[model samples]
Target chain A: AQSVTQPDIHITVSEGASLELRCNYSYGATPYLFWYVQSPGQGLQLLLKYFSGDTLVQGIKGFEAEFKRSQSSFNLRKPSVHWSDAAEYFCAVGAYTDKLIFGTGTRLQVFP
Target chain B: EPEVTQTPSHQVTQMGQEVILRCVPISNHLYFYWYRQILGQKVEFLVSFYNNEISEKSEIFDDQFSVERPDGSNFTLKIRSTKLEDSAMYFCASSGGTGLSDTQYFGPGTRLTVL
Candidate 1:
C-alpha cells in the first residue's frame, strides 16, 4: 500500500514570510500528487496537483509545489504567508484506482 | 461555478444505529467518491462511484457500509450499524474525468459523531 508522510505536525511563520510544507510519499511508480487546504469546519480545497510533466506545478492561492523524484517528495511552497493562510494542509498520492492516500496533515500557523 | 454539496453538516447517532450521509455532486462530473477523516488523522478513502456502480472501494468500506445513487443527483452512504469507531468526518468528491489529471472538487463534509 502507498503512504504519504508529512513530517511536520505544525509550523509557525510570520506574516509575509516564505513557507514550505514538507511531504514525502512511498510508491513504486509515478503517482499523482496533490495539496489541499482545509479551514475549520470546511471542506478540503484543492491547492495544487502534479500528474506529470514539469517537476514544478502552480496552484491556487499563490501556492506551488515541486516534485522531487529522488526524494519522493512533493513539497508545497508559498512566497509570502498571510494570516488567512493558517489552516491544515494535506498531501495525498493518487492510487491506480484513482483514490487518494493522504498524509496525516500539517497545520500552518501565521503570526503578525 | 458548480460545487459539490453535502447535507446534514453534523450528525450525531448512537451505537448500532443506522446513519445515512447524503451528497450531491457537481452535475457534469463522471466520478464520485467518499472519503473519511477521523479527528487528528489523515483523510482516508472509503469508496468511489462510476457508471452507476462501484468502481473501487477501500477495505474500510466493508460489510457495514454501502453506497447508492438512489436518484440522478443524490449520492448516499449508509452505515447499517454504527460503531464508536465510525465517528468521523465524511467527505464527498466529484471529478470530471477517469484520468488522473482531473481535480476532484469536494463538498463540505458531514461530521458524524457516534456515541
Candidate 2:
C-alpha cells in the first residue's frame, strides 16, 4: 500500500520570503512523485513531477522539488514567495495502475 | 494548450435520484480517470477507463457507479442513486499514455451536491 504524508496543514509566509513544504511517501519501489496546486474553486494545476533521472526537478511557476530516496521525501520549495502563490498544494504518488494517491494537502498563505 | 474539461460545474440533486456527470478529455489522450474530493480531504481515485472498459477501480467505485465513453469525445459517469455522502467535487483526468509515468492532466471538476 502506497501513501503520501504532508505534515503541514497550513503555512503562512511573507512576500519575498522563501518557502518549503515537506512531503513523505511510503512505497516499496521507486515512486512517481508530483506536486499540484489548486486555487479556490479551481482545478488542480500540475506544478512538477519526478519519475527518474535527476534528483532535482523543476516545475512551472518557478517551483521545484527535490527527491531524497533515503528519507523517502519529496519536498517543494520556492526561493521567493508571491501573494498570488497562495493556494493549496498537494503531493501525490503514482500507482502501478496509473491511479494517483494524494496527500491531505498544505494550504499556503502569503502576506505582504 | 490542451486541457480536460467537465460539464455541469455545480449539480444539485436530491437523494435517491440518478445523476450523470460528463467529461471531455484531451482529444489525443487514451486513458481517462475519475477522482473525488470531500471538502478539505485529499483527492481519492474512483476508477480508470481505457479501451471502453474499466482498467482499475477503487473500493469507493462500487456497484452503483458506472462509466462509459458513450461517444467519440464524451466520457460519462452515472450514479444509480445519489447519496448525501456522495456530495463532493468530482474531477476528470486523462493522459496520453497508459503508463504511470505519463502526466495526467485534470479538469476543473464538477461539484455535486446531494440534498
Candidate 3:
C-alpha cells in the first residue's frame, strides 16, 4: 500500500532560523505530493503541492517543497522561520484516484 | 475566496447514538471527501463523493458510516451507531476538479466526542 512518512516527530527552531522537515513516500508510480499545515484549533491548510514539474514547487506562506524521485522524498524547506510558523506539518501522497495518504505529521515549535 | 464550511464545530453524544455532520462545499467544487483525525494521529481518508455517489471509501468507512449530497450544496456524513472509538475530528474537503492535481480545500473540522 502507498504510504507517507515524516521522520521528524518534533522540531524546535529559533525565530529567523532555517527549517527543514523531511518526508519520504512509498508508492508504485510517480506520486503527487503535498504539504499541509495545521495550527492549534484550526483546520489543515494547504502549503504546497508537487504533481509534475521542475521538481521544486513554491506555495503560500513563503513555503516550498522539492520532489526528489531518486531519494523518494519531498522535504519542506523555509529559509527563515517565524514565531507564527509554529504548527503541525503533514506530508501526503495522492493516489491517482485522488485519495490522499498522510503522514503522522511533524510538530514545529519556533522560539523567540 | 470561497471556502468549505462545516456545521456544529463540536458534538458530544452517547455511544450507540446516531450523529450527522453537515458540510457546505465550495460552490464550484465537483469532488468531496471526508477525513478523520484521532487525537495525535495522522488524518485518514474515509470516503470520497462525486455525482451523488461514492467513488472510493476506506476500510475505516464501513456500514456504520454513510455520506450523502442531500442537496445541491449540502454534503453530510452520518454515523449510524457511534462507538466510543468514534471520537475524533472529522473534516470535509472539496476540490474544484476530479484529478489528483486539483487542490483540496478543507473545512474547520467537527470534533466528535462519544461518551
Candidate 4:
C-alpha cells in the first residue's frame, strides 16, 4: 500500500525565516506527489505536485518541493515564511487506486 | 482564473437524515472527485466520476453514499442516511485529463454536521 508520512505534527518558526517540512512516501512505482495547505476553516489549496521530470517543482504562494527518488522523500520548502503562511500543510500521494493517501499534516506557527 | 465551486458553505443535520452536497467543477474539466476530512484528520478520497459514471470509489464510499451528475454542470453527493461519524468537511475537486497527467483543483468545501 502507498502511504505518506509527515514527520512534524507542529512547527514554530520565526517570520521571514526559511522553512522545510519533511515528507516521506512508500510507493513501488514512480510516484505522483502533492502538497496542499489549508487555513482554519478553508478548503485545501494546492501548493504543488510532482508527476514526472525536474526533481524541483515550484508551487503557488512561493512554495517549492524537491522529489528525491532514493530517499523516497518529497519535502516542501520556502525561502521565507510570512505570518499569513501559518496553516496546516499536508503531503499526499496519488495512487493507482484513483484515491489519494494523505499525511496527518503539520501545523505551522509563524512567529513575529 | 478557473476554480471549483461548492454550495451551502455549511450544513447541519440530525442523525438518520439525508444530506446532499453540491459542487460545480471548472468549465471543460473531465474528471471530478469528492474527498472528506474529519475535523483535524487527514483528507480521505471518497469517489471519482468521469463520463457521467463512477470511475472509482474507496471503501469509505459505501452503499450509503452515491454521486450524480444529474445535469450538464452539477455534481452532487448524497448520503442516504447520515451517521454521527459522517460529520466532516466535504471537498469537491476537478481536473482535465488531456493525456496522462493533470492537476486537480479544489473548492472551498462544505462543512457538514450531524447532530
Per-residue lDDT tens digits of candidate 1, residues B77-100?
999999999999999998888565
- TM-score to true structure, per model: 0.96, 0.97, 0.97, 0.96
What digit string (tens of lDDT, one per residue) describes model 2 on residues B21-71?
999999999999999999999999999999999999999999999999999
* Candidate 2 Cα deviation (angstroms), residue B15: 0.5
Mind giving the per-residue lDDT tens digits that candidate 4 earns over B20-115? Answer: 999999988888999999998999999999998999999999999999999888999999999999999999998886645677788999999999
Q: What is the lDDT of residue B64 in candidate 2?
A: 90
Q: Rank by lDDT, highest first.
A: 2, 3, 1, 4
Q: What TM value does model 1 have?
A: 0.96
Stretches of candidate 2 above 4 Å error? Answer: A95-97, B98-100
Q: What is the DockQ of each candidate?
A: 0.69, 0.70, 0.70, 0.62
Candidate 3, residue B61: Cα displacement in angstroms equals 0.6
> Where is model 1 chain B poorest over a 10-residue stretch in terms of lDDT?
B96-105
Where in model 3 is the C-alpha error above 4 Å? B98-100
Which residue pairs in candidate 1 collide? none
lDDT of 4 by residue, A11-105 (tens): 99999999999999997777789999999999999999988989999998999999999999999999999999999999998843366778999
Candidate 1 wrong stretches, greater than 4 Å: A95-97, B98-100
